[model samples]
Target: MTDLLLNHRVEGSASAPPLLLGPSLGTSYALWDAVAPELSIGHRVVRWDLPGHGGSAADLIGPGASVGDLAGLVLRLADSLGVARFAYAGVSLGGAVGLHLAVHHPDRVASLAVICSSAHFNGAKPWQERAALVRAEGLAGLAEGANSRWFTAGFTVQRLVQDHREADPEAYAACCDALAAFDLRDRLTEISAPTLLIAGREDPATPPVHLREIADAVPGAALLELPGASHLAPVQCPEAVLTALRTHFDGAAPRGMEVRREVLGDTHVDRAQARQTPFTARFQDFISRYAWGEIWTDPTLSRRERSMITLTALVAHGHYDELAMHVRAARRNGLTPEEIGAVLLQTAVYCGVPAANSAFATAQRVLAEEED
Candidate 1:
């Protein structure tokens, strides 16, 4: 049993793939309670209270504390729990942490799901002013402002009053500092994991436009906009969020190699396992399910056809890490150099010549290595 420190909770099947949950600033793991039951049906959900919030140590604070710090903590937590690789889902501050993890430590993340967060929280003057005010007077000074931006009118008057009334003042203030400093706009393209971006249609804080920006920035990211919700969409509209998550993970097939072996035959599964190191092991389940199960099993397309489609999609979207993995999978699925060239040529017509050109270069590298 891993010692419960820093206000984190572990629940669901031990054998299942792990899901690291990052809560919004000023909120506890309780923020995820409404949705955890739904997610736990297929995942071993691990929820963390960001430092200075909820059950975590209050000592964790200041400019030293960052989104990268949070990502590192989650990676450490997963390691403690024997989870080499896992899916990540985060809300607001948590979402920023997920983005950082995907960009800086791609091997540790299998997939990323971000809710109601933006690459940059606010522009220079406004955010700095808010941070200064929070630091001076604490969260109460920011409460009215936060509430108005975070919830709908009815939700603000009713739901938020109950929730916000209990938040610790110091913790909330520290979170304001964290948000003020958070910025990842220029680095969004560096992330390699398959990503899901969910946003509230009515969320004044992060809005649908922010989600669209993230979708456009991150390669191979899918976006979902929820109706009649606010920044706290995980609580206000848990069903919609859960349903979309279930559908996405189900469609992606992010299962373990052992599970894949049971379903996909010994030879294919064994070859994949042989390639795994400690770092790559973290991504095996994602590769098995998404690469093998979901994409590979679609009867609508042959294996060769699916390989062609996947390679083209990864390349066109600029998901270079995934593109490399699929290029290898393409060969395993029996795609010859000629067939791979044909797919790249076809992609040039639909996905701009430059994108196809870049993909061709990547494909050539993979093919040469395989030949060697």
Candidate 2:
């Protein structure tokens, strides 16, 4: 609320786990418009504008600022909101701020996702030159080329372009100064929080290799690359960006999806998603959130046990087609072919010979497919 804090909007339940979102330079928190709402369902989403962007005071940052300074401002905003440790995700410059926080103030970040950003902004000379250009002539020139720099050809988000156009010249230049001085390459390995890196394959500002470098350096870090996307991925490919963030942050349906893919394999899950229609979308969500998310993800029973139970239930109900799928899943869960036969035999004794006969035929077909 104070001038010292960055301007931010909060969504979702106050009691939910806190998630902080940061914006790239030349844009406002509105950059998250397409993705934040869905993310807020399971998180206390706080999306902020940089100094002089959106509703933030232009004086929050001045000339010769560092990314560290921007990070400090973000900390102030989080502290003012009574948030201690939070999951963080950011784009470009905002991502740089997250890297700084993860490196310098590890205690405050629970997990991190960096999108279209780098550990070192490709050295300081280009940023220094950009700072000078903005300070001398302002942001008009940059705004004019915003779409090309930020998104793929024939795609545009006018609000972001306008945000670039309206950004305060001095503050924007100060942000450039921050980028000029920023370099966290050596400290990347110091990041202890769980990290994820997202890259737009076509991004000119920071390419996929930048993200790969961080993924290689940070212990247990993961990377995702979205094809056909440019620098501003959330604006250009919100669904992919949102899915990445949600999976990293443990959103309910996304968590289920992760489990679903693990249990069923990517080929099957991808096919299911590809065939999804509006009428079936809710049903799919239900399966992900409940069947996979809650039931399958439960640690109380081993996946092997669940797979056995699933096979019995499908056979008992005479769902032969689904029985084939569960047969495949059973194999994935490490059940031996003989063990699967035992489960089917038990089902025959309890349910009926006719149902079990059909189930065995289906399982035999799926098992043969796997062998092939």
Candidate 3:
């Protein structure tokens, strides 16, 4: 776990459900001021600075660090706050963190809302170049473009631009590195939270299509596209964003078992439960809570995509026994013989021919028996 202690401020009544607000890469928790006061009326709103930004330390966001690493920092921060589960709203990189928590730490999220963000943030060149420029010339160089991209004239304010200008360059650059390597396209189905996606139609950085891609992927996710709004929709149109959030949180609570079945199938889950014993109870409970309830339940990646990755991994590691079981589960999860073979064939190149050959033989036998 990262020892990053984030600077945070809490608002509203403590008795209310916790609403954790995270800011964009170059901004601090102040990014949410437009909506926080209104949101605090019904919830305990907690806003925190990004690592290396504001009062947070820089050492925690090390080079080549994955999104999960930064996400762990949020979990630790929540732990310190004694918040077991909370609703989340984030912008840009902050939204990415919300996505991470939904996937890796599902039980910790009550509901999620991401604005001007995508599962896979492409265009590594620009992000990398931005980081390089900041390192070379500092925040002043990026300020003008950042201001224009982040907000439209409707709500554009100098203070927000200053937030970008005054951001710690090293920390901002580190966040840029994380964004460059971020790709969760295949894992989108793994998010189990009841989700809401907001997009700015005029935003050049992450357009409505990005929001559409995620909206179409995550099951039952709601989407709102703000006209004339740019990358920072929350800043550009806080009233709309806040309205959607209140409706989403109040509408429905996502069920874990239903999402688990959607991803893993009912028969397979029942069988696994039947095999559980007192000695293995804790293990079963843990995976059920975290893996199935939290991770697999996410609507980010479909069951078929997940099965392919799982089958390939099992074959690569020579976990044939589990592989065989997964083969059956894979079939239930909609993997055809041809698809399974393709995954194995692809695995062969990196894992070795003998492994693929063995996997093929077993997979063929399973398919043939099922057909018979």
Q: Give the best candidate by lDDT.
A: 2
Give one digit per residue, the lDDT tens place, for model 2 in 1-372: 235678899999999999999999999999999888878877899999999999898888888899998999999999999999999999999999999999999999999999999998877899889988988999999899998899989999899999999999999999999998998899999999999999999999999999999999999999999999999999888878876787788833467889999889899999998775434555776798899999999999999999999999999899887888889889989999999999999999999999888888888888888889
- Candidate 3 structure quality by residue, lDDT tens digits, 51-153: 7776777777865666777788888888898899999988888889899889888899989998999987875787888788888899887887776678765
**lDDT against true structure, model 2:** 0.91
Clashes of each: 1, 0, 11
- Which ranges of candidate 3 are over 4 A from the true structure? 1-4, 153-155, 252-372
lDDT of 1 by residue, 1-372 (tens): 123455688888999888888888767788787777657756899998866666676655544356676676777778888989889889988998889889888998889899999998876466567656656766664555656677777664433443444565555655666677778899999888989999999888788898899999999899999999899888777767876776565554344444455444577566765664434543664566575557555678876677787888887798877677677777767878898889989989999898888888888898899889
lDDT order of candidates, best first? 2, 3, 1
TM-score, structure 2 vs. true = 0.76
Q: Every model's Cα RMSD, please?
A: 16.5, 5.2, 20.9
In the predicted model 1, the residue pairs found to clash are 253-289
Candidate 2 Cα misplacement greater than 4 A, ranges: 251-269, 275-286, 291-372
lDDT of candidates 1 onward, in order = 0.76, 0.91, 0.81
- What's the lDDT of the predicted structure labeled candidate 3? 0.81
